[model samples]
Target: MRKEGIAKRGEKNKTTIRKILNYISKYKGMVLASVILAAISVVFTLYIPILIGQAVDQIVGPGQVNASALFVILKKILVVSLITAGVQWMKNHINNRVTYYVVEDIRTKAFNHIQVLPISYLDSHPSGDIVSRIITDTDQFSEGLLMGFTQLFTGVTTIIGTLLFMLSINPVITLVVVAVTPLSFFVARFIAGKTFTMFKCQSETRGAITALTDEMLGNLKVVKAFSHEQEAQKEFEEINERLAGYSMKATFFSSIVNPATRFVNSIVYAAVGVIGALFAVKGFITVGQLTSFLNYANQYTKPFNEISGVVTELQNSIASASRVFELIEQPALKEETGDSCVLGDAQGYVDMQHVAFSYEADKKLIEDLNLHAEPGQRIAIVGPTGCGKSTLINLLMRFYEVNSGTIKIDSMDTRKITRESLRAGFGMVLQETWLKSSTVRENIAYGKPDATEEEIIRAAKEAHCDSFIRRMPEGYDTVLGEDGGMLSQGQKQLLCIARVMLCLPPMLILDEATSSIDTRTEQKIQNAFAKMMEGRTSFIVAHRLSTIKEADVILVMKDGNIIEQGTHQELLAQNGFYTQLYNAQFAR
Candidate 1:
């Protein structure tokens, strides 16, 4: 059964290779021209030895050693050599351009696909792994294809051309060379199969190391605060050691192919020399013919060695290519098609009916859920950490599809609307802030890319972040490092809130958006949010119960189900989950 599974997987890898070839097929004209040029170059190269033999015969067959005739043949060889060089250069140039273009197309496709992938997919896959597919794996594929084009066609043509030439000189010697050549193929095949498995393992281990590094470096602050550097290093070293082991094993197996083929080719060459001398002695062939035949024999077997080595390198490329193909071929989020409705002016009246969802098939998370929010209502969701509070928000944003239910925004089913338009109707501020390395002004204006300087300042002021901005050396023009590392956490949240304020969408979701701020700053931002939420439907998920005291409606939840819900005063009077949560914070 395991062997059957391995066979199926090998078939899949071949299918992936064909798909990669299809990407190359987009540049069919250029690829064909290169192949033709490669053939011409090989012919010129193979004809050189024949010219040398003829020149030798011309000089030796008669008394005076025909200097004029030999010179003419030497001139022809020089011309062919120049032409061969030019054609080879041209072929290489075209092949490289075609390879890079195909790589660029694949990278673009992968990035675009990533943009539309469901949030669940991103949640499950590591950012580093996805990045490896886009950059490292595709790059490896590019190198392989580039070298494959430069060698495979010309090498094969030289082998065939040389064989034909050798047959004309002495058939017996040609047969001997042919018989030993298959030994190289069998050896290459046997070794390549093992190298393929090792290379695949190496690629995965390399990605694992990248992921570990990304995770550790991204959280360096936490690691230091906990004094866990040694632990982090130990974890990284484990993965690094695994990667080294796989790489060494793969290279060891691949390294054996060249010398093994060379060994066989050396034997073939020795046999050709002895056998051809006998033919020459019997007067069946000339010494000149023996010389040409020996050249052809060497030429014939050299490609086998070259191809075997190329095949070994190509195993690494193919392993990487298979990884890239797996990512490209993953099922992306279902796209809205065939005249889906585009949101125009959203009213923000949302409802969930009989909603159900699960991250995994066997363990259901939310089931038979129902919720409704009137336009302009401020609905707050409060619960324990894994009680599906954020999951509810995820469902509303259509980030994950409901297992069996309908979500309607402004009385239109969300699935019927384009996700881009649907998402545009709402502005979100989450606990985990995302800010790129750019000027403060640009980060504020992210949601509304065309916002004027004045509009940007206005939003920053409204979010209570303008005071701190003015204190910075460059104010709004200051360039921030990755994730706005130059700013404090609370200040970063304020910038995020300012970004949302610029968009002024009709609906909002603030999932602990003010969690990083102190009470005074939180109060100021909350006042601004109050005004913003007055005429817009908003959902707030907060761990700090005091923040939602004035929310128009509060839903207390536990274990993926809403246990109680009412206004703050009403829920406090009931003395249930909400009462206990609110009291616990003040109790501390």
Candidate 2:
């Protein structure tokens, strides 16, 4: 089982590394430069100890040693060291540049992909997971890529070169030092493998904590209203404790690696010293040669330790990379066909034939429904909660796919039309209007980003929001708080209506659009709605029959099927579902 688990982990690591490589491919020139500089720096570092050994041998030799020659050698060594430092500095600079650019590219791709994902994907995934992908996952790539490659490359090169030089100096001492290499590697690998699992657990636990916090903060109003602050705090504390436990486990395993490697290294060094002394005393090797061998032994051990350290970091980074790659690997929403139909000068005729849909396959939400609306018609859909009134609008907008049916606009199948073009021809105003924190003019102009001030003012006027907006402290220039917190629900809804009006689409959808406003404001909004729907098709989904009294058609839906359809008066006369619904509300 452990072998199987290790295989799975290795495969995951390979996949994630491939993705990281692909990201780096975009900046090939910079990466190439960094690699070249890193190689040069490593070669110079190895040369330093060899030069020191040479200086020591010359100084201790019987032949006259010229001070000037020694000075020249020292100067040359200093220059080489400076050059190596310069290369290293440049490598770091280029690595950071590449890291930042690659990170930016990944972030942009993730965000853009999220925007294009089908609504069903968002419905299935938590918002916190998505946020973690953008923030935490990307940050991991940034941190790892910046230093992981340079360290791995340089450490390997330095170790190999030092080993070769040490072997050339005295093969016996080199053998003694090399004997401990495998043991060090085994210890490092064991600790790294265990720590990696802990790190993965830590990351998952952190994501859960983030999700819980986001949920609580998002519903702060409800929590406060119900006096549930202590409950929330307790929940948060539980998550926090879970995160801390996992973090400590990961840190403990990581901390063991260095100490274990260092202890083994000390033992190896002691063995090398004893073996060198024996060789020198037996006249098998000279004092100078033994000294050089000892230096090389120390050199080898240091890089070995450094390599072990790098490996630990690399393992942690691989864990993070796996998470990031998993997110990127999710199937993106299918793109619109190249030859998809486009809505141009459409008359807003809509038809649904044998329509069926389900959020999940076995649990259908809407089934075998049929409906039609002609140009310039007003239709209202009414039903109890969970009766799929909103689901119908969702299908119309192609937010979710129809299971086994067809929906057409202006005689063009929706499946054959691009999603952007299909949605472009409709104006939507929902019950909870979402406004960004921006100036009033910016919010109103969201429907038409390039709209002029005059056009903005006209849309606001048409929505009956101009009078109140004009009285605001800064009029159109006022900055709204997040989600339009500074405005009343009625005012926010009005702004949303104005935003839709600015688009001037051929078809309009008002989903409980007036449910938040006062009766007087609802009347005014209804008047504006009637004006806007004068020459366009409209669909109003409402629970209150009074709001749809003037609709040309009323459809009563239940259990994903339409049970009644007719004019308001006709439905009332029939005394069926629609009639009963109306009577119940009127009686109340």
Candidate 3:
């Protein structure tokens, strides 16, 4: 079973590499130019050694030293050197440009695809894992591709050019180099196969560390409150050590390839020198040819050594590329069909008829449910945790499609309306507030990017956030840290509320929007919300009973069904679950 798993992984990696190569082929023009320039450079460089050998023969071959001939040969060498330098520079420039642009395209596509990915995919995966594939893995793949482009043409050309020269001088010595070349290939392949697995593990471990860092630091307040720093540190240490181990093992194996190849090449080099001398003594080969052959033999094997050194980095690149490709290939949310309706001028009427849903297939959360809300009605949903309150909100917003149900908004099936258009009609402020790193004014005006300064101030005032904005050092212009870390929880919630207020959507959903504020501030915000909710349909999910006492209709939900729903006074008169919950909050 273990062997079969490893074999399967190897096959998958091979497929990933093929896909990456196909992706690179999209830039055929730049790639062809890079190859041509690299070929020119290698050919020019190889000509230098031949010129030197000719110069040596001119000066020392059974005649008075031919100074004129040697000088001409030296001049040719200089010209070749200059041309090789120019071609190499151009090749590297094109190679790097192609690498960066290809990586940028992949990164952009990956980021955009993730935006339309199913919400369930995001819920199941850690953010760090997704982020690692976007940033770190893409970087590794680009670096490897750049290295491959720079070296691949030169390595192949150099080997072939050197081998042909060696053969012309003497087939016997050329055979010696050829016979030993397989040893280098064997060593590289053996080590590289092992390092590939190790490097893949290292990449995964690195992502795990990133996830832990995101979790620990993002929740530092909770970690400190619970005095869990020691535990967190220990968990990080274990993950770090495991990453270190994988890295060390990969390094150890990859490092062995270089020396092993060099060892075999050295033996071949020594044998060529010995045999060439014997051939020279018998006059089977000229002294200059022997000199040239020796240089070519060294050149022939150098590419192998260079390639062996790059094997580990290439393996790491492949591992990272595999991860990135896997993410890019993930099944995204289906696109809107051509016939999908575009919602316009919503009336805020919503209905859920015989809705049955579940996050997991077998564990049904909501079943046989029916609900309705008329225009401009305040529908309050009061339920215990995990009773599908937020899930219902998710369904309404199309964050998650229902398992088996039809949700109609303003007399049109939600499935028919485009998600963007349907979501545009509703303003949502959840218990978990989200604020980007930007100025307070920008955060408040997020829902309406073109909101004027006066409009922003008015919305802030309505949400009761203007007073705090005025107290800030830069007022509304003050830049916030990530997720508005510089502000208090209540302040952040108010900014979110202000954003929603600026949009003035026809429908609103507030899931404990004021749960973090003090009672006095809550009362003020409630008054502001009352003014905002005058003619708009709204859904309120709250745990605080007092907040919903005046709601036009209250839904008493347990598990997933609404056991009772009515005006607040009518439910209280019955003295049932609603009364028990309402009295429980005040009984404290």
The candidate that wins on lDDT is 1
Q: How many backbone clashes does candidate 3 have?
A: 0
What lDDT does the true structure give each of the candidates? 0.89, 0.85, 0.88
- Decoy 2 TM-score against native: 0.94
Order of quality (lDDT):
1, 3, 2
Model 2 C-alpha lDDT per residue in residues 1-588, reported as the tens digit of each score: 999999998887887788878988999999888878877887787677666656665685567775676787688789989999899889888878988998899888888878877788888877886787678867866776666766766677777887888877787678878887778899998898888888788777777777778788777889999999999999989888988997898888888888898889888888988998999899987676677677777777777687787777777677776766666667877878887978887798999999989888789788889999999999999999999999999999999888898999998999999888888999999986899999999999997999998999999998889999999999999999888966988899999999998998999999999888899978987988898899899999999889999999999999999999999999989989988898899976
lDDT for residue 179 in candidate 1, whole number 0-100? 88
- Cα lDDT for residue 135, candidate 2: 86
Order of quality (TM-score): 3, 1, 2
Point out the worst 10-residue segment of candidate 1 by lDDT. 55-64
RMSD of 2: 2.4
Candidate 2 wrong stretches, greater than 4 Å = 58-66, 280-292, 471-474
In model 1, residue pairs whose N, Cα or C atoms come closer than 3 Å (at least 3 residues apart or on different chains), thus clashing, are none
Model 1 bad stretches (over 4 Å)? 61-64, 337-339, 471-474
**What is candidate 3's CA lDDT for residue 231?**
96
